[model samples]
Target: MSQRERGTRRVVRSVAAATATLAAAGGTLLACAFAAPGAGDGRPVAGPGPCVPGRCPAAYPDPHGGAVVGRDNGVNVFVGGDFAVRGAAAGAEGRVVVEGEFDLAKGSGSPPAYHVGAVGVGSRVPPDNGSPFLRVGGDLKLAAGQRLLAEDGPVNGTVAFAGRQTGTGTVSPKAVRDTGALAAFDGLREELTAASTCYAYDKGVPRKPTGTAVNQGKVTVFTGDGTSAFQVFNAPFDLVAPDGSAQSLSFRKIPANATVLVNVTDENGEARTINTSAVALAGVRRERLLWNIPDAKVVRIAGGGQLQGSVLVGRRSSTTRLSVAAVNGRVFTAGSLAHESGTGGAGGQTIHAYPFVGVLPECGTGPTPDGGHTDTGEPVPFPTGVLPPGFPGLEGLEGLEGLMGRPGAAGPDDAAPAEGRELPREGPPMRASMAVGATLMAVGAALALAVLFRTRSGPGSGPGRRT
Candidate 1:
C-alpha cells in the first residue's frame, strides 16, 4: 500500500477503537446508576401518617439517621418508629429508630384526649414482593436480631431498638397517675449501665410514645394539669448560660433532697413537664463547655440522679439536657440555651450533669407531697407557672444520658403479689457487628470495572504491537 494510504487506514482504525471504548464506559456508568440498589433517594422523603390514605407504603429520610421505611410485595404499609413497627397502607415494611424528642399535641378543648404525635408500634408487617418500604421523620436501623417494642409508659418520648425487650426490661409506671417511665425503665438502665457503654438511639425503649402517624389516636403530654399525662423530652436542655438567678446553681450543689423540674413551653402557650428527683447522686459537679447556639447559651452540671426531661417547640427547637441535684454540687443553669449551629446543619443545646454519686431514693408508692401525684421516688411537678429555662432542647454526643437526668437503676418491686402479672420484657439482642456486605460488594464492582478497562500487551508483543 502507498505510505499516505496506510497512514489514513491507521487513523480510521484508531477512531473506531476510541468510539468503542467510549460506548462501553458510558453503558457501564448508566447501569451502575440504575441497576445498583441505593439505600434510598439521597433526599428528604416523608411517609403517610397512620390516618392518611394513599398507596400507603413509602420511605423517607429519617430526621434521625436510624432506619428506612417502604412497602414490600404490594401490600401492607408500615411505620417503624423507635423499637417497634406499626401498620400503614399498601404492602410495605418499614424500619424506624425513634430518637430525640417527639412532641405530642393534644386536643385543646372539646376532644380532650385525642393524641397528635409520633407513636411507637409493636410488630411490623414485612413487605411482600420486592417493593421498597417507607420511612418517616428519621432513618430505620437494621438491628439483625433486635426485637421491636412499643414502650407505652409514663415517660413518653423515646423509641429504642437494640435487643429484644424481655418482660424483665419493659418499663411500666406504678400508677395510672405517674407520667414517667422510671418504673418500667429500671431494668433497661441496669442492663445499659452495667455494660458501662451506650449508643444513642433516637427512640430508646423507656419513653416510646403512643399512636401511629398523626391522626386517629395521638400521644398525650401532661402539662401538670387536671391529670398529668406523658411528657417526652423533645430536645436536650441548654443550661450553659444561666439567667444569673439563685435558682440556677451548679447541678452538683442542688440539694440532695431537692427535685429538679424542666418546663418546656411552645410558642402556642402549650407546656410539657419533665421532672426527676435526686433519689441518689453520683460523681462530682463539673462546669464544662456545653454548646453555643446562635441565639442561645449553653451550660452543663455534672452529677448523677434520676435524669428526666422533655423536648418541645418546632423541628428546629428540639434538644436535650440533664437536671440533677447533688449534696456538694452547685446548680449552674444556662439561659437562652436552645438552638445552635454546628457542622452539617446545627448542633442541639444540651445540659450535662456529671461526676457525682447516685443513690436510689425511697420513691415509695402512693401520693406525692403535692398530692394527687404518684410518689415514684422522684420529683413532682408543682403548680408554679414559672418554667425553668436551659432545662431541655439541645443536641450533643450520643451515648449520653437524658437531659432531665441520667437513667437510674430500677428499684425492687413495691406492689403486692398479684396473680399472673407478667414481668416487663427485655429488649431484643443487638447485632455483634454492622452489616458491611453492601459496601464490600460496591468496592468489588468498582475494582472489576478498573481491571476491565486496563490495557496490557500479550507476552508475544515485544515493545509495541501493531494490529
Candidate 2:
C-alpha cells in the first residue's frame, strides 16, 4: 500500500483503540459508583438506628409523637367509658371528651365548681350546678337534666339536650356531632402504641425483673450508654418509695442526648399495674422518658407525688385502666381513665398533657438481600439540579463544579419550571451515583471526540500521495 494509505490506516486503528479504552473506563467508573452503598442510586438506604429528631419526617412511621401532642393539646380528659365526677374538683387545660354517660354531681352548700376547658360527651350528660362555672368551648350534650347552673346565670358555651331540658340553659334543638374530637382520641391512642413499639425496638434492652418479691421501699434505677439506653422488664413491679410512702424510680448513667425506655409485663402475659401515687422520677424529662406497658390493666398515679413522661398501656384485645391524681406528662390507655378528686392542690387533680418523644427503628439503607441492582437495566438519566449541599460521596467531585453548575442550584432556565418538577422531596438515594455516572460518561465522550480529531488531522491526507 502507498505511504499515505498506510498512515491513514494506522491513524484509524489508533482512534478505534482509544475509543474502546474510553468505553471500558466509563463502564468501570459507573460500576464502582453504584457498587458503593448509598451512592445515590434510588434504593432506600438504611437510616441510622434510633432516628434523630428533625432528620426524620413528621409522618406515620416516624411521626414525632411530640409534635402530635403539640397539635392535639386541646384535648385534656379522654374517657372511653361512663364518666362521673362527684364532689370532686377536676379541671383540664384543654377540651374533655367522654365516650359514655357523663354525670357531674353538684357540690353541697354551694353550686358545683367543676372546670373543663371544653366538654364533648358521646351519650348523655348531666347539667352542671355552676360551682366554679361551666365555660365550654363547644356544645355540651346531655340526656336528661335541669339547666346548667352558672354563677353568671347561664353557661358560656352552647348546650344540647337529648330528651328535654327543664331548667334555665339555652338548649339547641339539633345535637352537634363532634366526631373529629372522638376520632382524635382514637388516633392518639394508636400513635402512642406505635411509638411504644418504635422505642422498644430501637433503644430497649430485654431484661427480666430481679428479686423474687416486690420491694415496696426500694427503688429501681436503669441506665444506658449514649446510643441505646433502656430496661425491659418481663415481670411485673410496683412503684413505691423507700419510706413506705411513694416509690421512686430513677435513671442514671445516661448520656445527655440519649433516651430511656422502660417496658413492663406480667408473668401471665399481661401488663402489670404501676401505682405512682407516691412515686418520684428523677433525672428524666417527660420527652425522653417512655413507659410501654402493652399488657397493663391499670396505671394509677395517686397520692401527692409527681409522675413525669409518656405512658402507653394495654393492647388491642384488652382495655387498659388509668387512675390519676397529679401527672406531669401525657397518658395513653386503651380502657378507662379515672381522675381522683382532692389529689393534687386544693381539692383538684392536675394531669398535664405533654408531648412524647420516642425513638424510631433505624431504616435499612443497605442493598437488598437479593443483591440485585434497582435499575431495570435501562439507564437512569442523570438528574437535573446541582448536587445537594453537603451531599455525601461528592467531596472529591468539587473540582468539576464548573461543569455541573453551583452546588444545589438548578440548571439555567429562563422560564419558570412546572410545579413539582423539582428534585425528590425526600432526597433521592442514588442521586450521587447518577451524578458520578454522568460525569464518567461525559469524560468518555470528550476523550472520544479528541481521538477522532487527532486521527483525522495527523499523518494522513495531504495533497495527493496515491491510493
Candidate 3:
C-alpha cells in the first residue's frame, strides 16, 4: 500500500483508540450516576386523602412523601419519627413508613437485623401484591441479612430507603437510596393531639351524662350512658392497677358500635407516665375504642399484653421497652418516638394496624380546673369538619420526614437507636474501590494512543513523524 494510504489507516486507528478510552470512562461514570440515588419506589406521585372504595378513611391520615405513597390498607406503624432494630429479625404486620432514619442493626458488629417480606403485614384479606412493605424516608443502614421475603421464598423489589445506605448487608433487588415515599406529619400531629383533647374535652354534648370510670383495683369498669355515637369516659387515674399485673379495662352498656374515648389523665393535669396493659374489651371493639393519653409524655405497654384500641398520644411519645406489647389500633403519637422492636417473645407482639372508625363530639377545648372550659384553641373535630394542613388532604406535601415538634420527632439524629455507630453517607469501602475501573480504562487508552502514534507517524511515510 502507498505511504499516504498507510497514514490514513493510522489516523483511523488512533481515533478509534481515543474514542474507546473515553467511552470506557464515560461508562464508569454512568454506572455510578445510576447507582447514586433517586426516589426508590417506582410508584406514581399521589395527592393527600386518597380514598379506597370499601374502607373508611382513617381519622388520622397517615403521610405520604409529597404524594400518595400508600393506601390506608392497614399501615401498621407510621413513625413520623425513627427507630432501630436488633436481636432476632423484627417484622411489621402491615406497611411501616418511617419518616426518619432506619437502621437494620444498631451498628457494626452490634447485632444482625434482617427484614423478610414483600407484601404488607397484619391484614385480614390479601395484601396488594406490589407495594413496598417497609419504606424509610431518611438513610437506610443495611445489615448482613435484610431479605425482602415473598410467598415462594426470599425475594426482592419492595423495600425503598430515601437517604444513604451503609454496610454490605444482603438486600435483594439491591438496595437503593430513596423510594420517594416521604411525609410531613406535623399538621397531622397537631390534628391528632387536638382530636385527643376534644375527645377528653369536659364541656361534652349538652345534657349528655358523663360516663363513670370506677377503678376496681386490677380492672377498671367504665359504665356508660345509653348514647351510642360518642361515649366519653374519664379515668381520674392511670389505666394500670397499683401492682401492674392483669390491669384490664371493662366497658358496660356502651351500646353496640359506639365510638368510645377513655381519657386517662393525671389528676393535676401534669406530665406523667401511664403504663397501659393489653386491655380486654367487652362491649366495644378495638376499631371503635380510643385511649387518649392526653397528658402522659411516656407510654409503656405491659410486656406480654396487647392494648386493644388506638392510642392518641397528646404529648410527645415513645414506646419504652416496647417488647411484646402489641397495639391493636393505630399509634398516633403527638411527637417523636424511640422504638424498641425485635425482642417480642414466642407469641411475638407488634403494633397491629387497625384504623380508628370513631365519631367523636366537640367540647369547649379542655376541662378547666373547676370542670368548666379552658379555651385553648378551636375544637378539633373527630370526623374532622375540615381536614388540617397535613391531615390527608389534596395538597402535595414534599419530603418523607415529619421533622421536630411533630408527634414522634425526637430529632434528626434519632434515626437509629443511641447505642449503634452511625454509618457514613456512602456505605462500605466498595465505592472508593470503584476508582480502580477508571484506572484500567486510562491505561488501555494510553496503549491505544501509543499504537496509533507508532503506526501513523513512526517509520511510515507520514511527514509529521518525529525523531
Considering TM-score, which of the candidate structures 1 and 2 is the better prediction for this target? 2
My TM-score estimates for the predictions, one after another, are 0.18, 0.44, 0.54
**Residue 212: error of model 2 in Å?**
15
Per-residue lDDT of model 2, residues 186-219, tens digit only: 2223223333333233222233332122443555
Q: Each candidate: what lDDT? A: 0.20, 0.35, 0.44
* Candidate 3 error regions (>4 Å): 1-74, 86-89, 106-122, 125-127, 143-157, 167-176, 183-186, 202-209, 267-278, 317-321, 338-347, 362-467
The better-scoring model by lDDT among 2 and 3 is 3
lDDT tens digits by residue: candidate 3, 373-405: 112221111211122233332122111111111
Candidate 2 — which residues are off by over 4 angstroms? 1-89, 95-111, 118-218, 226-235, 241-245, 269-271, 277-282, 316-324, 342-346, 360-467
Ranking by TM-score: 3, 2, 1
lDDT order of candidates, top first: 3, 2, 1
- Per-residue lDDT of model 1, residues 1-467, tens digit only: 63323333332343233223323333222222222122121111111112111122343221221221322111111111121211110100222212212111111221111111111221122222221122122222322232222222221222322222232222111111122312222222112211111111111111221211111111112221112122122122322223321122122223322222222222121222222222222222121111111111112222223232211111112122222221111111111111111112211211111111222111101000111011121112211111123222112211112111232211111122235533223222111001122222332233223222222111111101122
What is the C-alpha local distance difference test score of candidate 2? Answer: 0.35
* Poorest stretch of ten by lDDT in candidate 3: 41-50
Best by TM-score: 3
